[model samples]
Target chain A: MSELWAASALSVRIAAVATLVTVLFGVPLAWAMARRKFPGRGILEAIILMPVVLPPTVVGYALLMLFGANGWIGRYLGGYSIAFRLEGAVLAAVVVALPMLYLPAKAGFAAVERELEDVATLMGANRWQTFWHVSVPLARRGLLSGIVLAFARALGEFGATVMVFGWQPGRVTLPISVYAQFEQGDLNTALPTVLVMAIAALGLVLVYNALASQRD
Target chain B: MKHALIRLVVLSAVLLGVPTARADSIRVGAAVSLKEAFGEIATLYKADTGETVEFVFGSSGQVAAQIKSGAPMDAFVSAAKKQFDDLVKDGLLDVETRHLVAGNELVLIVPAAAVKGGAVGGFDDLKKDAVAKIAVGEPKTVPAGQYAAQTLKALKLDDAVKGKIVFGANVRQVLAYVERGEVQAGIVYRTDAKESGDKVTIVATADAATHEAIIYPAAVLSKTEHGDAAGHFLDYLMSEKAVAVMRAKGFSIPTDPAPAAPAKPATP
Candidate 1:
């Protein structure tokens, strides 16, 4: 159905955007956590990874407080409202998916041979150059797998997205559509949407596994 | 290691046995709005009969779907007749046990701070430029949302306010949005508005003529093995004691006389 296709496309877009945002911020934060021995590092790591352990609804509620009209951050958006919009859904997905991406990316950074980075640095390469050339290439597979995992997680996100943006027609993702169909007792529609999501998720996991298993 | 494994198995068995060994239990699926009232009634029912009544609370549509999927619920108390009717049509519920229990009123609520300005008087005011967003449950899945939509349509304001609508998954979520001041106004049950304390103020009660009757219907499932117990629970729900509890929670008890309790079937 056209509705199903639209919902699937929207879900993919939301997840892709969320995953992109996650990687942009997560890679650097993960690298810093993995490579540094800074003070408060333990607390910082716990805060980054908190979403993984907390209930999705709790994360959603916290986001709601932070991004709501009366919220501290939301009040200063200068008349631009983020709640009940596609952007809010993306923000929700990023909150829930960030930890999933960060953890694996952190592990990837930690797994990279530090000696190679040091060698690159000693050869007159700057820190940023050494990181991109030596550290990133060595950990590319793990990082890619992490990105895939985060995309998959974001695609299936429901609790936080619902809490933050509710389920607007043009903004409803695949998971929300499936839930709405099921709740409306339209099993005919719900089952196929579920199947599509399941297959897509399986495909994502397969890609991740393939990338992860590749020998560098 | 072998002795410890045997001990662990024995411990697990004992833990699992504790509940099944006690009083007979029945699973009742009720709408989320009925949670507090039903929980109190459940406690009272347990005190009187020594029976354990477990409740599964969710949106009426979701609960009905579970019943259709053959959820092991002994009784279902729904916030809407459509869900009950659907189950009856599917032969999942005993038609004879179905009874209208209580009624609720839909109300428009605004954040407490907004009430002073009086900028929002009713559904028409929602079209004002100052009202940025309005929250209502998703009409496709929530009964409260259906009523809200009906009311809006009746007032001919559906088209005018269509763009400002934000749908919550359920009535409680709508209430939350209003309570948190995330939306300028929200539509929810009067009871839900009451629960939000000082955070929200009721702006108007939707006219009953605008929407179908907001009724709660209770029924026993045909698939229940504990038919007698389920029937008894249904009877208890109609009793004056339960009616009082429902009333206290802002529900209007049905005026119809209570159905006679069914005779308990002989246990094998």
Candidate 2:
């Protein structure tokens, strides 16, 4: 029972941080791609959306090359190794869930009428101000749904996370715990953990649907 | 609906739980083969001593590699002597704390219904047409597979059963195959066979002499911060109580003190 709670706590914490990071990077990129057409825009979109189509193991491998001690990105970080730790898990989740948020948020941004932004600019609103005040408010539903979708995707990520940070004590997430228990034939424990994840995912999907529903 | 977005953001703020301080727990890296028994022992250990034993179960090689790279494990329990010896050579494991926890026998298991059939009796029977596929661990990686291969070669049955063998990733997968009747039989650790309960029946024990000795060795990591705590848990694993649980799980207790039993009570 305590194992269940510990796993849940660890998972929620990792996924929360991952979701926050996803939105931080995802929202901006999504908006950019949604608003302007730049050179290599198709290539950029393909890369951003690659994670959604690629197998988690492939994504995990790419991240490993970037973050692993011997890899380019990792070599620069010096003494900070993310292997088998919270940060690694968060990174895996963010990579895998980024596209989920980006896709919907792009749609949300695209749905926002260009006239509204023009109206804000005409009223002397700066680009940043118009973004926060007019663009964001108009695209609220798509963005909200995207955020929820990303959160749910991150919560369920397992393979890439495992590949990035192999299993570790004090780092067990709900999916990992369930897999561990099931491997040991301990269905009694695994079943409850599975139930917890199922409920969590269901709740997130509900939130997504609620936000996506147009009340006006 | 009016402030739904604001409420949702607040909700995420709560879900973004503040990182809590780690509890008084020692992280132990152990072989994947020990997953079930070790988990049970950890649970009991927590009950007996209010301290926790958190584990990271993986292949002996993977776990050892992690330890070498400074994976923050307080203790290590390897499924084979080779991995333990390698770590000891690297001065990663405390030599003094190292001990032989248990040894294991390779068991041949078949689906429950096939147990009584005369069609499959021993290693030789695996060659028969009735046994279409016989599951064993991949000899290159899985310890159980290596031992099973050794046993067949030692018993002069390797050529006879070679064509019928289907390799699994690990002992647990072999047991799963046997339990599902996907394979007519499987060769896996005794503990794995036992975990399947009645779903699979042990057809034969691949005598210990036929293969290299299967040993599980444990020791504290020399770099561990909680040396005393990890040592205590290691001692508990070799304690009479924990040994009893391992024995019931079908593991061989090699150095277990001769049990004080088989004598009638004086009163009786």
Candidate 3:
């Protein structure tokens, strides 16, 4: 079934874009969390970790309420409806994968020697340049880990995706396709997509391992 | 390991990325409930016409969404008229080619061994002490689940079995849950029980009067490239050979007008 391939392609696009979104939002937040003690910092950390602890179905239900047709946000964005569309799938992936990116990034940033950023600052590097040129390179392993892990998690996102995006053309991701085929009692038909995902996930883990060990 | 991954990528690219539809084949999006019956029908259809009818099976609601979003299905066979009618309103179906493929009866099923002692007899018996959990498809998307809810409500037993109901995503899932003995019983089409062989027992058949009439409506898609082939496939669904296969699989020819769903919902 071509559905399998379409789903695979959809999954990749959703995850890749989702990871980019996660990095955009998560990395800055990770830096703040790692370096600054803000008001209600504990609450922020709890919310960031909640996704990993919550049942995916509950997360899906919560998202459906926030992004469904009748949801306030959805109603306001009628012309740009995210529900039952590719954007909704990417949003779900981004939401679920955010913490996967944030935790590693925070740890990576924290592990970066403060002295390096201080040295860069002393050597006439501006705050932005020092943070980007010094802190980023030093935290490379953790950042790479987060990206790969986030991408993998995003690629496999399903419950929230099916709840918000629903299963339709331009939106059916790999997991949903596999569910549809298996629901039909067609295991043979579901196998190729399953294999693709399995191999892809394995490859990501290897990539993460290689990156983790590169310095050693 | 790297080579293996590379080969898998290329193999899947060749096998799944490219279009699987041939000029002579018509891509059909069908309800998953037809998996067994249509598998047999497709075989007979291919033998008779030498045309491959590639079926993409899912819940009726799912198939409707696919048709709405333009999944390139040449035809559709919906489990009920609501989905079919929805497609009609969306201007996705070739209304002239629509036909009633069969009428199905909703039945109560249990693990084959559970009823060996006749512990459960009917819908009312689902509330019995021995039955702890009953599986039904989620009524929102799965048509059989909606029908099951209606059947229980008509029998004034919905309230009694409400707490113990375990919602499966689809009828096959409900059947599987019952077969695995994960649930004491399930409500599904009689055809499911037929395919299940000895894995599950048909404990009781719901009376037709208790719920909306179950119907399967088949139609060619409006945007089909192989319109002629799709129309012929619809015709084949009505042919004697296809009917025989359907009948053998426990589907009954409907006496009602084709596409006129006998439910309170508007007929397709």
- How many clashes show up per model? 0, 0, 0
Per-residue lDDT of A61 in model 1? 82
- Residues forming the 10-long window of minimal summed lDDT in candidate 3 chain A: A74-83
Candidate 2 lDDT tens digits, A55-125: 99898778767776444677577624454457888999998989999998999899899998999999999
Best by lDDT: 1
| Candidate no. 3 TM-score | 0.54
Model 1 error, position A15 (Å):
1.9
Candidate 3: where is the Cα deviation over 4 Å?
A1-216, B1-23, B256-268
Stretches off by above 4 angstroms in model 2 are A1-216, B1-22, B116-118, B256-268
DockQ of each: 0.57, 0.02, 0.02
Top candidate (DockQ): 1
lDDT score at residue A62, model 2, on the 0-100 scale: 84
Residue-level lDDT tens digits of model 1 in B1-268: 9999999999999998886432479999888888888899999999889988998888787788788777778999888877777887787887678777889999999989778888788888998988878889878668899899999999998988888888876788888888877788999999888877799999899999999999988888988898889889888888889989989889998777444534444559
Q: For each candidate, what is the lDDT?
A: 0.85, 0.80, 0.81
**In candidate 3, what fraction of native interface contacts survive?**
0.00
| i-RMSD values for every candidate model | 2.1, 17.1, 14.4
Give RMSD to native, each candidate.
4.4, 18.6, 15.9
lDDT of 3 by residue, B110-131 (tens): 8886777676888888879877
TM-score of each: 0.83, 0.50, 0.54
**What's the residue-level lDDT of A179 in candidate 3?**
72
Best by TM-score: 1
Q: By lDDT, is 2 or 3 better?
A: 3
